[model samples]
Target chain A: MGIPIYPVHLEDPKLQGFYDGLAAGELRITADTETGEWVWYPPEIVTGRPDATLEWRTVAPIGSAYTFTTVVRSLLPGDHKAEVPFTVVLFEPDEAPGVRIPGVLVDADGIEPACGMRLRLKPVRAGDHIIAGFAPAQ
Target chain B: MKAGGVAITGVGETPFIRGSDDTVLQMIARAGLDAIADAGLTPADIDGFVVNQYTGHGSDELAHVLGTGERRFAAVADSAGGTATTGHALMLAQLAIEAGLATHVLVPYAIRSTKPGGVYAFHANEPHKAAFEMPVGFFAQPTYFASMANRYAHEFGMTEEELAAVPMTYRAWAALTPGAQKREPMDLDTYRRSPMISTPLRVADCCLTTDGGGAYVVSAVERARDMPHPVVAVQGIGLAFNNWPHGVLFTQKPCTFEFPGEASAQRAYAMAQVGPDDLDLAQIYDGFSISALVQTEMLGLCERGQGPRFYAAGHGMPGGRMPINTSGGHMSGGYVPGINLLIEGVRQLRGQEGQRQVPDGGNSHATTILARN
Candidate 1:
């Protein structure tokens, strides 16, 4: 099946770094310039300080498979309908203790997914859009 | 003047079934009319309106049909999910009545999402959906709950038999409910034969998508005593949000297999000046059987990871301690989101549930907590 273009809102300034990093094959995160707090999902401001400066920080792509589920039946209409039994994994970055990110576990279709398995980011082009996912780290 | 001084004077619900010929708007009107009648009040008495935000059904439309002239308060509960909507509405109504903003507040919830293509395409249009969720094929509601079930099973050593017993318990209660969608007896054998919608979650584990509605009439506790029905006090009210970012998939939750129920219930119980031991019956939200278990656990009815065993042992059945979802709950009772659960809670407290009534009902509470991504 041909890869379909899933819509991504790059117009959001808080989330612009995420999409840009995916396109660049890097996992970019937001960190507080003043408090040194690492934010996995982008936010408008730091934890407590609205005046704290924020900047994009790149971390190692390696993470552990926190938890996951297999979609045996497709709830969507388009190309996803044909992609049944695909594994969706939530990975916990080694650098970020509490933050967890969700993505598809690419490759290893017949392999049963296990918790605490090591994985790495694998951003690839799907049609005109870049989709980010995770694969077992070498 | 106190927060818990408000009361649910009347309760009404449209038939919970697989298909309804009535439109959502018509159902809302009927429920409102029935509630007003139950409360022994005229439509002119209602000056406040609250509705579920999902249907885009405005309070003005409801107020117009109900003849609630010159509405003083009109609002919609947050449509985050089915769990917290009812609580949010009741809390708002209580505040309005306490603040002297409105005398009688009408809260009604209606849905037609069970029909063909009605609920299957319920995709959240948040900025996060397009980025994380949709691309991974986590489209429907069950997939998210299924993920929670899998993680719960792995972490807590939840057995398949334990999981299957939940629906069986609800079916036993539903058998007594006349208007319930699934009245057939569902034993463990039947549950095992059901197909898998997702891993660790079978078809029997999910809630019904009924096209129906439910409504409640709220007024001052003093006025409720003089009304037509028994006064069910709006005792304790608590709300907790898990701070999970929108569009984050279920697996990425800050705490999987755990809702903010502990904190919310603690606040509610404290406000009511009652603990889990004080509750005689509970109308727990059962969007899925697992959700019911989680809610029960978090409510302090049983220890964590021991909910399935507690439910299976008949403690939640009629005539048992802490009878739950006596109206069959969302699973077998026809899911009108969480509004029906609230109505049932009031019914139990009022001794209105005929055969399903808890024997000499004790302090009753209706509550739901959901942490969505």
Candidate 2:
């Protein structure tokens, strides 16, 4: 509890489903009910049109690493020191278009990741919070 | 004539130093008082105002302490990053003058980046930071920009020395600047040897988190004629928001390295009635060294994918084909938000930068860029 960091308040009404999905080991995102567009990072409403509703859709738990960085230094205080030199990646799911999400590349240290390398989602618990991450596809 | 009837009459700033003794209020107030005095006006004459976020007690506290009359126009600018803060502050002040809301307007920006909690303060505050970004270990701005720099280098085959030139030029310029924080002369060797903050971003490539504040007085063109210093005209201005998804994450793009400033720059140039060729110098925001390169390209200063080559060819240096970040920019000048760059633009236009002055003492026209990532 060095910095008192907390995960997304799944307790909130708007984001309850996203957190519940993570807790349940299901990866969910939103798609336009009208335009058939997949939205990553789970938008509350369809982009650009407030009147349109975004429907929750369960997505494949696998993606490809689009781009990433190897953090050699720790910028944050506390338990982050042990996490130095970890890899953070922006990944594109196989099902989404123009939508990418970010997460730590679990167990990716010493691994030279090439673009389009397949990665699968893994949700782990930190303190009382559940965080999403990715591991190289076996 | 982008937004007419406005001219920057005076620019002032407290020393750009790391771990300064001044409090946030003191830093901003000192700069504001100096600017108002430089404009040859008093607090009472300042009818309009805008300031970057310091805390809740911003506009009213400052106005009261300055002993000003009825506050005709006073508001705080926040949420947007540094560049947008500067642009919106200026635009709001411009609108105040043009719409007869106020005769003279004041815009002030200050940051205590060197404070123990300064850099990470936004983590808990930005609505999305605490939950989505910080929990995943994306704790600071540098890592976010570093990803783009890495991708850009990989895609374009930009050599390490070419990337090194970005900070190298700024450090050289900063040496000439008296109060600049990192003014020591830096050669390619020093930059190459600097510690890596993140992959593809060395320590020198990131902006110094120093404490400082800057303020500017904007007056009608008629009032500018009667002022003491040469007029730094607000010739043109433009602003663009993160229209794409995920804001700074920029997940909407097939290539994540691109900056979204093309539309903003085009709009500003259109309003100014000048193209990139007509610009004498640019003070584009350099929160990260690579951002300046991307912004210069997006602003049409050079062709896309030519930024690395442009700097490597000895452009953007003093007396080079293109003059950029002449006052060391945020890298050396201290991140006084983006207002310090605006101050540098005014100083260059007025032929006031002593050693770092561009050739021709700044041509007949000048443009200072404030771009958000």
Candidate 3:
């Protein structure tokens, strides 16, 4: 099934790095440059420390599924009826222990998606752009 | 605040309908009037107000519509969902009443879920969700809770039957609740037949799409002695947050399945000088079965990770030892966020809910309470 088509708002400067990394075929997430701690979804300002700066750095593409759901109904705003029955996985990269990246599962012929299931980043094309998709790892 | 310092003197709600022409403001006005009248007072008698921000109606707007008297104390519940309308609003109302800032505070909330945009529209428009989640088709409460259900089952070992028990328990009570929205009988087979929205989360597992409103009048417990209802006083209340804003709540939490209900529950139980065993009944916020399940454990209704088993064994069903969501809850009752559940709690405590009321409701004292997250 095709992924649901919704415009990724690249207008937010913090989120632009994720899509930019997707274009380069690498998995990158935001982290504090000074502390080197992962701050996910790239908050405009760190929780308490407003002065802390965030930087996008590439990490290991291979990861394990933290949690997943096989969406039988598309909750997207528009008509995404044809995009039913897609499994969305929150993949935790090997490098980022607690951080999870949302992606659609792909290239699993007979593999079942479960927590702690091994997966690797596999970007796939949607309607007009590519999204972070993952395949079962060896 | 001290126990029995303030009490819910009156409660009212509009009929929970699917396609009602009532706007949010209209519904609240009607419900607010009903509550005011129930307290044997006109709108002009109400002085304090606790208005919910989610209603998109300000204190000035509510005052104007209801024609209430001078508002000595008026505050807004700035949080969202049940946390704002139920937990935070009550805390604020009691604080004001105890501080002598005001008495006769009206806290009202209503929802037009069937509005121009459906219930899921709000989630679709979130900036972080639009950026990170929607692209992968991960949007809406069902999809988000569905993911949490999977993680919960994996950790705690939940069977499909165990999960089905959650909705089944609530529907059993709804059958006796004449005012409940979906009162048709629902068994295990019927639950299985409910269409699946996401893995494990069927339509039965989600809260109903309700267009209705509910409001309650809070007054000093001493003032409620002359009011028309039994004193369902504010014995204990608690609310805690980990800075988990709506944006990162679904995805970035260390353990997304775990809501911070325990911390709040512990604090509330302490304040009341009571334990979970002391509760005669409870009304947990049932936004989703997975959420209700975890909350059931957090509220100490059952052992942690045994919520499914607790319900499957008929612990929360009618006449069970621990009666929960006595008015069918949001799942099968009405979804006015926490307001309806609060109304139901008051009704049950008042012993006016014909057949749905719990037997010997409480200890003739102050052991009963509603625990929210």
Give each prediction's root-mean-square deviation over alpha carbons: 4.3, 4.1, 2.3
Candidate 2 collision pairs: none
Cα lDDT of candidate 1 equals 0.75
**Candidate with best TM-score:** 3
lDDT tens digits by residue: candidate 3, B1-373? 8866888888889999888998999999999999998888889889999998878899999999999999999999898778777778888899998898888999988999999878877776568888889889988899999999999988999999999998999999889998899999999899999999999899999999999999999898889888877787777777877788888899999999887788878878877777888887888889999899899999888899999899989998998988888889999998989888778877777788888878766521112253210
- What is candidate 2's lDDT per residue for A15-120, written digit by digit as tens? 4555566788877766777887775555544557888766677788888877777677657555465556667777777887566766677756566865667899
- Locate the minimum summed-lDDT window of 10 residues in model 3 chain A: A1-10
- Candidate 2's error at A108, in angstroms? 4.5
lDDT of 2 at A100: 72
Candidate 2 vs 3: which has more lDDT? 3
Off by over 4 Å in 1: A1-26, A32-36, A44-56, A79-81, A107-110, A122-130, B1-4, B79-85, B114-124, B249-252, B368-373
- DockQ of candidate 3 is 0.80
Superposed by TM-score, candidate 3 places the C-alpha of residue B234 at a distance from the truth, in angstroms, of: 1.2
Candidate 3 colliding pairs:
none
Predictions' DockQ, in order: 0.38, 0.41, 0.80
Candidate achieving the largest DockQ = 3
Proportion of true inter-chain contacts also present in candidate 1: 0.43
